[model samples]
Target: MTESAPTPQPDGLDVYVITYDEEGHEERLLPSEVTDAVVERSRDFGINKGSWTIDRIKHGPLIAAESQLRLVNVGSLARAIAGNYYGTALIVDQTPPPIDEDVYDIDRRYDVDVVDDVLVAVVTQRHPAQPAETEAEIAARLARIAAAYGCRIVGVSFALPGGGTPEEMLSHWPEGEEWSERFRAETIETLAGMAHDVKVSIATDDNVTMATLMDGAAAMADYLSATQTGPLDAAGVLNLLRGGHFNLLIGEAESGYLEVKTQMHPISAPGDTGKKAKVELAQDVARFANGDVDAVLVIGYKEAPGGANTIGSLTPVADSILNTAQIHELLDARIVPPVDGLIIEKFVVTATDSVLAIYVPKQPSEMQPYLVHGAIAEGKVEGAFFSIVRRRGEGSITTSAQQIHAYIVAGKRYLRGND
Candidate 1:
C-alpha cells in the first residue's frame, strides 16, 4: 500500500535545519545552510534528497541523543521548537507577539510547562528592577496564555523556602495581587464562562519536587478512567496527598467515582463558596453511596464544568476552613444507611491549604440505595426531607424507581428464603 506524502511547507518563512559539526559546537543552519556532510547524515536517516517538508525539518535531528543522531545542528530541539512554535515565540521572549487578533503571548516573567498532560504555569516573581506585575497584568497574562495555548491555566504555584504547600497553595498574594480575594485569572474564566476563548482554574492556595506531582498526576489520571480504576480507595490517594500532587489533576475529567469540589460547604461552619452545604453534602454522599461502585469527593479542586466536569484547577480548602471532623459530621448527619466503611481523611497541601477526601465504599446489595434527609434550601434545614442520589458517569443522577424496586424485591425474596 502506498503511504501519503508529507505535506508541503510554505516557502521563504525562514525555516531552518540544524545539525552539529565535528567540532561539537551547536550549529543552526537555514535551508540554505544545509552542508554536504549534514545532507549525507540526513540521507542516512532516510530523509533522502527531495523537497524538504515540515516533518522532515521537524524530525531530522529531534531524536538525536538516544538514536545517537548527535547532530550538533539539532543541539537544542526544545528551544528550537519553542522558538518557532506558533510564529517565532522563542525570538521575542521580552515582547511576545499577539497569538491572533485577540490572544497574545504570555509574559516572560511566568513560565508555561506541560507537566503530565496538564499545563502548569509557574509565576517567577517579576524583576525588582521593573515594577511588580499588577493584578491586571497577571490576569491579562493568564488569559493570553490560556487563549494562546487553547487550554485552561491551572493556577499558580509559589515555591517558597522550606517544605509544605503553603497558604492558598501560594496561588494568591503575588507581589501585586496580595489584597484581592478573587484571583485575577479567575475573572477571565468568569467573564468567558467557558473553556475555549479563555479560562483559568479556581485558584487554590499552594506546590513540589514535581516527582510526587508526576506520580500523583499519573494516579489521578488512572482514577479518572472508569476502565482503569473501577472503584476508588486510599492507596493511590496517599500519593496525591504528598507534595503538590494536586496540580497534576489539572484538566482531568471527572468520572463515576471521581468528584472535585472547589469549596467547602457551610455545615454549621463558615464556608467559602457553597451556601447549601447540608443539601450538597447529602446529595454528594448519597450519590456515591447509591452507585454500583465506590467513590470519593475531593474538596479543594474546581471543575471547568462543561459537558464533562473537567477538573480545572485547585481551590484550596484549608484545614482551618474544613477538616475531617466536619466531613464526618456532615456525612453522618446527611446520608442514611451510614455509608458503611466510609472513610474521611485530610491531607495538608500547604500549612494553610488542605484537601478533604471522602471515600464512600461500595455497600452490600441490601444497602442498595442510600438516602439523604434534607428539606434543605439555601443553607436552611427543614424537617423530614430526603433525597436519593446515584452516580452515573460524571454526574449525580436521581435514583431510578425501577432500580429501587428491584432492590426492594430482592430484599423481600431474601427475607422469605425463597432462593
Candidate 2:
C-alpha cells in the first residue's frame, strides 16, 4: 500500500493508478502481479491514456493538482471554454488547493465499498461543521476516479429531503433546469470515454444516503433497490470479471456469461470421467463462443444439484486438479474448428488452494454456432456425436432442429443455381 508511483512529468496532466486488490480472502491472497502506480499524460482525457483508480484521485495531494483534479473542456464547458469541445488542455497550468494529509484521512469525508462487484463510493460532506463542497466538485472527482479505474459505468446518488425519481428529484432541486439540461449531461459527455457510461441516480424518501450514520451496505441496498434492478449486461459482466468481485464465481449463483463448476473434470483419471470431462469442457466453451460477449467458466465452486442451480461455497482445488494444456487439448479434440482467444488462468487463493478460470471471448460470425464433437449418453461416452448449445441468462440449452433446418435452407438459397 505504501508503494510510490512514477512522478508526474512536466507539460502533461498527471494521472495515477493504485495497484491494490481489496479482496477479503481469509488469508491475504497474493496477487500474481504487482503493477506499481504510475503518473502519465493523455491526449485530451485521462481515461484513454492511463489506468487509474478513484481512491488516489481523491486522497493523494498534488503539486499542481498533485492530489486533486482540475477538469477543463468538459460537457458544455468545452463549448464554454476551448481546444475540441470534448478534450482538456494539454498542460497542468491551474493552481491546486492545498490540503492536510492527516486531516483528510482522520476527518469524516468519504467512504468506498464494493457492492455486488460494483464500486459504491460516497462523498459525505453535507454538514455545516465540515467545509462546503465546490461546484460540481464531487462529479469531477468521480470522472478522474473512474478514468483511473477504467470502470465501464459510473454513478452518483444524492438523497435529499424528498428525493425520488430523476424527474421528481430534479423538480426538488434548487437549479434543476440549469443542472439537467446542461451541466449534468455536460459532465457525462465530458467524461465520456473515461468510463463507458456515467450518470447520476436519485434516491430520496429515506435517510440511507447517510453512509457514515448507518451500515453502508444497508444504505446502499435501500438507495439502489429503488433505481435499478435489471439483468446483467456485457458491461456488468465485464466489471464482475475485472473488479476483485469473485463472490459470485465462487460462492454465488450463475448469470449471463458466467458458469461455475464445483470441481474440475478428472481428465487425467482413468475411466469415463476423463471422456465426460472432455465433452463438458467442449460444450461449455462452445456455448460461450456462440454468445455476444466474453464469458468465464470458474472451476472450484459447488453449485446446487438441480432446479435453480444456485452456486455456493468455495471448493478451491489443488493446482494439479485442472491443467490448462489438457483443457485446450480437450477443446481442440472435441469442438469443431475450435474457439479462438481462450484465456485459461489459475489464481492462488492461498498458499495451497487455487481456482481455475476459463475466459471464452466472443467469436466472429464466420465461426457462428460452434459445435461440440462428442456427447454423453446412458452413463457412457459417445465420441461421434456433435451438438450445438447456447447460453440463455444463467442456463444453457441445445439449438432446436427447426433452427438448423432454417439455416440449411438459407444456405441453399444463397447457393441457388450451383446445384
Candidate 1, lDDT over the whole model: 0.49
- Which tens-of-lDDT digit does each residue in 41-106 have in candidate 2? 211222112332112223221112223232211121111112222222221112333323333432
lDDT string, candidate 1, 216-331, tens digits: 22332333332122333434443454433565556656787778788877666454234366677878878888777667788888887575677777788767767677678777
The local distance difference test score of each candidate is 0.49, 0.48
Best by TM-score: 2
Error of 2 at 8 (Å): 45
TM-score computed on alpha carbons, candidate 1: 0.43
Per-residue lDDT of 341 in model 2: 81
At residue 72, candidate 2 shows an lDDT of: 16
